[model samples]
Target: MIQRPRGTRDLLPPESRLWQAVEQTARAVFGAFGADEVRTPAFEPTELFVRSVGETTDIVHKEMYTFEDRKGRSLTLRPEGTAGVARAWIENRLHDRSHPLRLYYIGPMFRYERMQAGRYRQFSQIGLELLGADSPLADAELLLVLHELFTRLGFDDLQVHLNNLGDPEDRPRYQQLVRETLAASREALCSDCQRRLDENPLRVLDCKVPSCQVIVADVPPVSTVASEASRAHVVAVEDQLDRLGVPFVRNPRLVRGLDYYLRTVFEVVSPKLGTNAVLCGGGRYDRLISDLGGPAVPGSGFAIGEDRLVDLLPDGFKVRVLGLRRLYLVPLGGAARAEALRLARDWTRAGVVLEVELTGRSLKAALKRADKEGFAAVAILGDDELAAGTVAIRELATSSQEVMSPAEVPAWWAGRS
Candidate 1:
C-alpha cells in the first residue's frame, strides 16, 4: 500500500482542531497589532531565496527543494516566509500606499533535512512583517507582539535571546574577527564549520557540533567590533524592551542564519522544548525590499515553527470545536426518515448541528446508538410523530423526553444550558 511521504503529517479530526486553535489565536493577536494577513505562492523563482537568504546559509545551500520547470526555469518551494512577503511587497508596490505596511502570513514551508523532534521536511510557519519602519522601537514592538501571543497561548516560561548583527558598515570588521579566530582553530572545527570559515565565518557560530561550539566559545562577541551607531541601536532596543517589561538576554553569538538580518536579531526560546529548539526567530532587515528589486524599505519580522509550538502547548489547553453541537436525529420508519431529512436541512440552515440517521432502526436501538455516540440530545421521529408534524426530543443527559414542532427544536436546543 502507498504511504505518506517521510517528514510530512496528516492532520486528522481532533488533532486538526488544535491546529485551528493555533491559527485563530495568531490571527486575533496579529489583527490587534494592525497587521493584515498576506499570502504568497508556495514556490518562487530559485534566485529569490539565493539572493535574499544568502548562498552560504544552510537554508539555501542545503535545505531548499530547488528544481527546474518544463520551460527550464529554476523554481523552489519557499523555505521561509519573509523573503516571499518582501518580494510581494516589492512586486505589488505596497510601498506606494503607506509608510508602514503591517502584514502576517501562516502556511506550509518546505525544506529537506534530517527529521528530528518538532522538525520536518514539510513544516508550517506563522509570521508577521512590519515593512517601512526603521527604529529600535520597531524591533521592540515585534518582540512584544511575540511575547503577547505566546503568553495568550499559555506559555509562561519563555526566554527571548537577543543580539545585534550590527549594520552593514560594522559587519565586515566582525566577519574578519570571526575568520581570524576560527582560522586558528580550523583543524578542530566541524567539516561544515571549516567550510563556513572561508565562505561566511559568522555562520560558524551557529554550528551545533560540540567541538565547533567549544571553539566558538573563546571568540569575542560581535558587539565588540560593531560601530558606535550599531552599539547605540542595541542600547536603544534594550531600553525599550526594559520599559515594556519584556525580559531578554544579550547573547553576542546570536547571529541569525539569514543574510538579510542587520542590527537587531532575536529568538524566543522555550525551556519545555529542550535545550536548542527555538520557537521563533526574526530581526530587522533594512535592505531586503531593495535587494528584492523594490525601493529601499526597512522591515522586521519573525516566523514561529508551528509544529514545535503545537508540541509545546500546555496539556490543559482546550480548543472548542465550533459547529459540532451533539444533536442527532433518529427515524424509526421510511416516512419518518424522509421527514427527518427535511428537518435536518432546515436545522442545519439555521446553524444547528444535526445528524439524521439513514439506517432503519427500532426506537430502542436508535436511542441506544445516540447514547453510545455521546449525543447531547436525540430527536426521535416515528410515523405518529411525523403525522403530527413534531419530533420527540429526548435529553440524553437527563433521559427526559419532550415533544416539540420541528421548527421549535432549534430554539429548545439553543435554550439548553
Candidate 2:
C-alpha cells in the first residue's frame, strides 16, 4: 500500500472536529478585532519570500520548498503566512481604501524541515496582520489578541517573552556590535552561527548551540543600542500591555528568527511543549510592505502554530461539532426506504441530520448500526407507520420510543436536550 508522504497528516474524525474548533475560535476572535479574512495562493514566485522575509532568514535560506514550474519560473510553497498576505495587500491595492487593513488568515504552510513532535514539514498557521498602523497600541493589541485566544482555548501557564529589535536605524548599530562580538569568538561558535554572523549578525543572538549560546550570553543587548525614539516606542507598548492587564517578560536577546521584524518583537512560550516552547512569534515589520513592492506601511502581527496549539489542548477535550442534529432513519420496506430518502433531504434542510438506510438493512440491523455509531436518536419507518402518517422515533440514550408526524420530526429533534 502506498503511504502518505512524511511530515503531512490526514485529519480523520474527532481530530478534524478539534481542528474545526480552533478555526472557529480564530474566526470569532479575529472578527471581533475587525480583521477581515484574507487568503493567498499556497505558492508564489520565489522572489516574494526572498525579498519580504529577507535572504538571510532561515525560512528563505533553508526551509523554503522552491521549485521550477513548466515555464521555468522559480516558485516556492509558502513557508509562512505574512509574506503572502503582504503581497496580496499590495497587488490588490487595499491600502488605497483603508488606513489600516486588518486581515487574518488560517491555512497550511509548507517547509522542508526535519519533523519532530508538534513540528511538521507541512503545518498550519492562524495569523492576522494589521497593515498601515505604526502606533505602539497596534503592537500591544496584537499581543492582547493572542492572549485572549489562548485563554479562550483553556491554555494556562503561558509566558509572553517581549523585546525591542529597535527600528531599522537602530538595528545596524546593534548588528555591528553583534558581528564584532561574535567575530572575537568565531572559533568557539558553531558553523551556522559563524555563517550567520556575516550574513545576518543579529541572528547570532538567536542561536541555540550550547557553545554559541554561551558566547551570545555575553554580547551586548539590542536595547543597549536602541535609539531614543525606538526606546520610547517600546515603553509605550509595555504601558499599553500593562493597561490591558497582559503580563509579559522583557527578554533582551529575543530577536525573532525572521529578519523583517523591527522595533517590537515577542514570543508566547509555554513550558508544556518542552524545548520547542514557542507557540507563537511575531512583531512589527514596518518596512515589509515597501520591501515587497508596496508603499511604506507599518504592520504588526503574530501566527500561532495550529499543530502546537492543538497539541496543548486539554486531554480528551472533544469539540462540539456543529451541524444538523444526529438522527438516523431506519426503513423496513421498499416504500418506506423511498419515503425515507425524500424525508432525509427535507429533514436535513430543517436542521436534522438524517442517515437513511442505503444497503437495504432490516430495521433491527439498522437500529443496531445506529447504536454502535453513537447516533443520538433513530427514526423507524415501516409500511404500517407510513400508512398511519407517523414515524416511531427512538431516543437512543434511554431506548424510549415515541410516535410523531413526519412534519414534526424536525421540531421534536430541535427540542431534544
Best by TM-score: 2
List the candidate 2 regions with Cα displacement exceeding 4 Å: 315-325
Tens-place lDDT digits, model 2, residues 225-310: 88888889999999999999998999988988888999899999988877688999999999998988788899999998999888
- Per-residue error (Å), model 2, residue 33: 1.7
User: Which pairs clash in model 2?
Assistant: none
lDDT, candidate 1, at 107: 99
lDDT of 1 by residue, 122-181 (tens): 999999999888888888889999999988888888999999888888778888998887
**After aligning candidate 2 to the native by TM-score, how far in Å is the CA of 2 from where it should be?**
2.6
TM-score: model 2 vs. ground truth: 0.93
Candidate 2 positional error at 325, Å: 6.1
Per candidate, the number of residue pairs that clash is 0, 0
